[model samples]
Target: MAFFGFKDFDRLSEVDLNIYRFFTANVDKVPYLRVRDIAREAHVSNSSVMRFIHKLGYDSFPEFKVSFRAEQQQAHPTNHQINFVTDQNFPTDIYEKIELVADRMQQADQVIFCAMGSSGALAEYAARQAAAVGFNAICVKDPFYPLVNQLKNTSDNLLIALSVSGKTIELLELLNNFINNEDVTLVAITAEPSSQVALMSRYVLGYSVPQQRIAKYYDLTTQVPALYLTEQLISTARRLAVQAGDHLI
Candidate 1:
């Protein structure tokens, strides 16, 4: 409730606004982040982050976070409502898609996790978890330069693209690069099954969350579904590998 108020943030500079947006979008993770971490994620200077905190009438980042967490803790218990993607009754096809994605992940030689913005952070985390279970995985935040350079010659790779809308331009362009490549498989964890990314993906694990929009741009769509999908894929793949006598550890 405290973080959602925009009166003060609306009066700030553009850089501060971007920082506010990032903080708001990722408010759930703020309790674990430092001032420098927020600055880096918001693409701003540490001084700017301090100034932004001061603008909210906090003398220091720790004090500000204490209040932020207090406010969240106060509201979170009541806010633990049903999640459409995780708690609601989904159709049979939803589970089927997850199984198919798990099958593809188990068979792939390597895994590439792709996303943009906050989702890229998630992709990196999923990649790390997959690698821990012995799957060769890497996170590609940008599909342009570094990713293209690293994965140019690789084939038999599984791409797990996470986008709530499934319409990110850069991600789609990257997916299209291997649209006809039989050696690469695309698995989409998205909110919209009809989105370009989902349509092009070989398997789609979609969620049923109400798309949140501000000024005709999607802003607040939760990614719990993507996280769920990644965890499921990792667990399913791990179990299958063990059953097949493939030493995952």
Candidate 2:
């Protein structure tokens, strides 16, 4: 919601940026936290909190918190927790979802795994796993010269994109080109189904894990959910391929 429809972040002072980072990092607790609570945790003054609130056009923290929580609730109506060991909210129909993705992979002329940074390594692993299962899979390591864009003859393609936040600018830009492509069946594995990339996907595997950051910009979210999802997808697709061949025989 563009930071809950607040756009004055760029106007914040250098010191204010600290408060901004803390606020974003702890957004799940924002509406419940008192202004003094925020001030203490963010290591800022009460007046600085007031200034930050005012800069975002809220007359007071209560007013801002209400709006923030409302926007968050409206965007995400369901819990996204995917911790297999502890997340009771883990998707109940996950196997069904994996089957659908497997169908897409089995039908594809080629499969592409798209991601960057930490997720990029996972993408490479997924690509190799898919290849081992006999699918023509490749990972796009560099967005500038992606093999997905260069392929000409393949009409049916399956794209598996992974991102913890699903807000990566480069990945979003790359997806912009495939939003309307009838030939591409996109499966977005990300932290939130409401994220920009997930919105563009034909199928989505969303998981809720804690987002951790280093230096306020580097993402350290756990990739276990993504890894598990890809492994399940490849396994299902391989089995489906064999069954379909048997039926043909």
Candidate 3:
């Protein structure tokens, strides 16, 4: 939701003000910071840090961090966004998972992307990316009902559902209805591994990152990870296709 940005800044005490200033100046370091770390950096006690977060109207440290990160995302979105691709465990964890799905992708007759909102836009872009690599891929943006109907009769198709939260009701509803089909494979690309869309899908490619809605308007995550996965999948699938003696295009 929307919070009064600078208006709330004036309500803090001197100690809290110092901590706030440290946080603002070092906003880039906020993601890796702990409560004790903040206290140490601001030269304040742990209790003071806790109180500062409370003064900001947050109930917990993690909640405050989420909002703070979202704010930073909105303000400094250019080259400062978290790099999910080069992260330590990302290559090890995510690449292995991508390999598991690459074969299915190569074998699939059609690729269908389903999503709404910003995710829908990503799905369209992903479809074009796949098509550029010589795969038959399509995206369904809205009026998802027609897509749902079409999915019922489709077989040997890969459905990639793109949603950061994986909690979109329409997307979940579609998954619930289509999960029983053996010939139609379901894949969920989401940030939350435990989300409904992940559980319902046959396979999941999860991006574990801090996803938040900034000021109730900006979605501060999803696109980067989704695009990363799309590029990797297309590359891997292309490689595998060449290995199998099948020329794409």
Per-residue alpha-carbon lDDT of candidate 2 for residues 146-180, written as tens digits (9 for 90 to 100): 55446645689888899888998899888777888
User: What is candidate 1's CA lDDT for residue 145?
Assistant: 44
Give candidate 1 misplaced runs (Cα > 4 Å): 1-89, 146-149, 215-218
lDDT of 1 by residue, 1-249 (tens): 255554855569998888888887887998789988999999999999998888877888888898888887776756465644544534457766777777778878999999986688889999999999999998989767465556678778898899988888889888887788787888888888899999998888877777787776536767677787789889998887888788898
Error of 1 at 107 (Å): 1.6
**lDDT tens digits, residue span 1-249, model 3:** 222276666677999889878977887897689999989988999999998788777898888878888887787677665555655424357878888788889999889888877898889998998898888899887735576567667679898899889888878877676788787899998888789999988888887666779897677774777788878887898788888888785
Each candidate's number of clashing pairs is: 0, 0, 0
Regions of model 3 farther than 4 Å from truth: 1-84, 88-91, 215-218
**CA lDDT of each prediction against the hidden true structure:** 0.81, 0.82, 0.81
The total of clashing pairs for model 1 equals 0
State model 1's lDDT. Answer: 0.81
